[model samples]
Target: MKRFINKWWRGRIAKLDLCPLPKALAPLENGRVLIFAPHQDDETIGCGGTLALLRKNGCEVKAVFVTDGGGAGGLPEGTVAIRKKEAAAALAVLGVDDLVFLDEPDGSFRNTLGFEQKIMAILDQFQPDWLFMPSVLDYHRDHVAIGQALYACWRRWQGTARAFFYEIWSPLPATWVVDISSVAELKRSALSRYELPLAHCDYLSASMGLAAYRGLYLSCNGQSGLAEAFVEAENNGIWSGISERMLALRIYFEKLLKR
Candidate 1:
């Protein structure tokens, strides 16, 4: 039954001719892009390829790691410093020089007033054309929290910045996809920098595989390519509806992540 539904849904979307596969190529050059990660490695896992593509197209890119990444999410204690180092190396491969570390608690992100203020401060300062964050439907609590907080910040600020939500532990209902076949190797190298986290989870292979899957049906020829999925931030009515539905199941998801 699930398989049938999935096939029917794919078939329904396949008929569309949105830029030849729902591809978004706006502001492809000379744009400001800001990305926020719940952990040291989430940035790379979520949109490393898009980061590379953006830099290649001359976009000013800034990445912010929202957590210390220590003794949480299966990582060991005292690993925060090392993870930051790893992040520097990984982002370097993507040609990202501007980085920020918020040093908030790992696996424990609350949408507190202070937290929202910090996030909004960056929005005011950077004034990014594109803001990258994790998807609210992601499996991890940290991912969801960061996404929600970012959403809330945008709500209050109501700035011109556009939000692009990426997939990590959960697949997003993508509004568009960015072809990253040109920088697939760069993304692979970036993912390889985090040896410690790779040991815990094979994100390199998983991310690459997901990218391939995203590109498989959308590619021009029979050859398979790599792409990254992004769901643009919806308007207030739609976004509020989605958030309310997700929050209704917060208790269940929290228990699942904790266990």
Candidate 2:
């Protein structure tokens, strides 16, 4: 029954119209992009293709792993080190050279002053124009904690950065979608770097299908694929719900202006 369902879904996804890439929304040349991942593999799963696109378009991208992801069951000890290596490999595949690992305890992440301080310090130093983090509605405890902490920090920053939430274990009602059809293979290759996750294939395949489904919904080519759906929140003067394609286009144009 599940196989039948999967087949049906895949067929439906293949029939949808392709969404064309839109103009860049904000300038990203002088701007920095910060992606906050709750675990090592998430950076690849959520934004791998988008990161590649950003680099190709000349945007500086940075990623911060909120936890060491040592708690993924079924590993003999030293899983954290193993996963960190996997993350590094994955980031390299996505063309991300600037990566930071917070090494917070796997299952024990909290919305505490210490964590906030660490995040705030990074934000202050990087001064990113766009910030990406896990969605508030994710099923993982660590993801939610990071989202809450980031939200508080964003409020304190007062619209200095445009923030968007990406998905991990939960489905986000995305207000913006990035057409990632062009980099689907890059995303898959990046995800394959994670070897500790016994069920990594299932996770990766489901995410790919979801991205295809979203691409169809956005009228993008079904085979081209999409990545990185974001829910935007209105903070201070900056508003959410702007198209992700438009946002990328804006960043591209902004980079051109800087050059």
Candidate 3:
């Protein structure tokens, strides 16, 4: 039933009258991107293709793992250490050399000053042109906490950077989609580096299929392929292509329904 629902919604998304936003908002050139992942492997799952695309376009990308991912069960005492190693491997596969780990306790992430300070320090130092964090609507407590932290930080910083939210184990009300069609394989390879926990789950194929669906929606609307989606929280002078993409998606999904 879960699979059926997912498929049903996927097809509905295809027929959506999408209004894709312009590409100018996500300008890859002369931009610094900081991807904040709640766990070690999320960077690859959520934005690996974007990382690869940015790298290919000569953009600077840095990743920060917010937690050690020690509480997902199945660890044999030194699980955090193993997860860190696996994370390193995954980043290396994606060609992202700049990485940082907050080393915070997994499954207990909170929106406290201590946590905010650590993230603030990184943001101040990096001063990224763009920031990516988990969606606020995620089902996981840690994910939602991280999103709140980022939101608070962004507000404190007066929205200095372009902030976007990615999805993981949750459904994001997407306002923008980035075509990652060319780098989908690279994303798959990067995701494959996390052999510990993901090896036991069926995430890769489903994730890829989602990307494909997003791509098809973009293509039908006369845009690029393989895509990652996000919702724009604040648009202060940033010309995000959200409205355009949404229109395109709506039309695509409507057309699919006619078929």
Which one is best on lDDT? 1
lDDT against the true structure, per candidate, is 0.84, 0.75, 0.77
Clash count list over all predictions: 0, 18, 33
Candidate 3 per-residue lDDT over residues 5-81, each given as its tens digit: 99999999999867654331354775788999999887787778888878887778899998888985656898888
- The candidate maximizing TM-score is 1
The runs of at least 3 residues in candidate 1 whose Cα sits more than 4 Å from the true structure, single-residue gaps closed, are 1-21, 24-27, 73-77, 220-224, 246-259
Off by over 4 Å in 2: 1-30, 72-74, 198-201, 220-225, 236-259
Q: Estimate TM-scores for all models.
A: 0.84, 0.76, 0.79
Error of 3 at 119 (Å): 1.3
Q: Sort by lDDT, best first: what order?
A: 1, 3, 2
Q: Rank the candidates by TM-score, best first.
A: 1, 3, 2
Give the distance in Å from residue 13's predicted Cα in candidate 3 to where it truly belongs.
19
